[model samples]
Target: MLTIRRHLVDAIVEHARKDHPDEACGVIAGPAGSDRPERFVPMLNAARSPTFYEFDSMDLLHLYREMDDNDEEPVVIYHSHTATEAYPSRTDIGLANEPGAHYVLVSTRDEDTHEFRSFRIVDGEVTEEEVQVIDGE
Candidate 1:
């Protein structure tokens, strides 16, 4: 299960909505080994495609460096799907290198509804997980 704050969820949804038609990608970092998500780091989708998302290589490197300096790790890695369900594609499972991170997908396929889902992708295997959103601070 992935337990996260409500405000964080709202923030992610907003980012996704803002980037509709092009996938929005980002990470939520937290203290190493804490399994908590506290910092929202919105990222550029290098691909800028409605069906795909790729973090800019330079930005990813910088983010890793900063997270290291701050003693943080990416607890949640997220992306948006403009016209699809909130589920991982085959490419997503193949590209998931962080076995410990929660992979979140937000779908903005409908104007009236948003689909938010979380998964764990390890070694080409995808496992859907429970998400518990807590009240905002």
Candidate 2:
């Protein structure tokens, strides 16, 4: 299960909505081994496609360096799907490299509704997981 704060979830949804037709991608980093998402790092989707998301290689590298300096690890890796369900696509599965991270998908297919789902993708296998949102720290 992925245990996260309500505000963090809201931020992700808001970012997704802001990106609208384009897919929004980002990461929530926390202390190493914490499995707790405490920092929100919104990223630019290099692909800028409605059906796909790709973190800018340079930005991703910088993020990794920053995380290392802070002793942090990505707890939640998230992206938005503008016209599809909140589920991982084959590309997403194939790109999954963080076996310990929670892969979060937010679907903004409906104007008035959205779907937020979490999964574990390890070695090309995807498993849906429960999300528990709390009041916050």
Candidate 3:
């Protein structure tokens, strides 16, 4: 299961809405090995495509350096789907690099509703997981 704060979940949804028509992508970093998402880092979708998302290469490189300096690891790797369900696509599965990270997908297919789901993608396999949103940070 992926245990996360409510506020963080809200932030991700907000970001996804703000970038509707184009997929929004980002990372939530936390203390190394903790698996607790503490810091939200919204990223630019380099692809800027409604069907896909790609983190800017330079931005991703910088984030990795910053995380290393802070002894942090990406606990959550998230992206929004503007017109699809909250499930990983074949491309998404192929691109999953962080076996330990929670892969979050938020679907903004409906104007008044959205679907939020989490998954574990390791070695080209995907497994849906439960998400427990808590009240506080």
Candidate 4:
């Protein structure tokens, strides 16, 4: 299961909605080996396409350096799908290099409704996971 705070969920959804028509991509970093996301780092979609998302190479390089300095790991990797369901695409599975990260997909196809789901992709296989969004105090 992917356990996350409500505020984080809201922030992610808001980002996806704000970037509708173009996919929004980002990462949530947490302490090494914690598997608990604590910091939300919204990223620019280098592809700038509704059907795809790419992190700028420079930005991703900087993120990794910062994470190394902070002793953090990306616990969650997220992106929005403008016209598809909240599921990993073939390209998504191919691009998932972080095996330990939760691949979160938020579909912004409808105007008011969204389908937020999490998945684990490893060795060309995908596994749906339960998402438990807890209220933040």
Instruction: Report lDDT per candidate.
Output: 0.96, 0.97, 0.98, 0.96
The backbone clash count of each candidate, in order, is 0, 0, 0, 0
Pick the winner on TM-score between candidates 1 and 3: 3
lDDT of 2 by residue, 25-79 (tens): 9999999999999999999999989988999999999999999999999999999
* Tens digit of per-residue lDDT, candidate 4, span 1-137: 99999999988999999999999999999999999989999999999999999999999999999999999999999999999999999999999999999999999999889999999998889999999999873
Error of 3 at 3 (Å): 0.2
lDDT of 1 by residue, 42-124 (tens): 99999989989999999999999999999999999999989989999988988899999999999999979999999999889
- By lDDT, highest first, what's the ranking? 3, 2, 1, 4
lDDT of 1: 0.96
Ten-residue region with minimum lDDT total, candidate 4: 128-137
Estimate candidate 3's alpha-carbon lDDT, on a 0 to 1 scale. 0.98
Model 4: CA > 4 A from native: none
Per-residue lDDT over 27-53 for candidate 3, one digit per residue giving the tens place of the 0 to 100 score: 999999999999999999999999999
Who wins the lDDT comparison? 3
Identify the runs in model 1 with alpha carbons over 4 angstroms from their true place.
Answer: none
Stretch of 10 with least lDDT, candidate 2 = 128-137
Q: RMSD of model 1, in Å? A: 0.6
Evaluate model 3: give its TM-score: 0.99
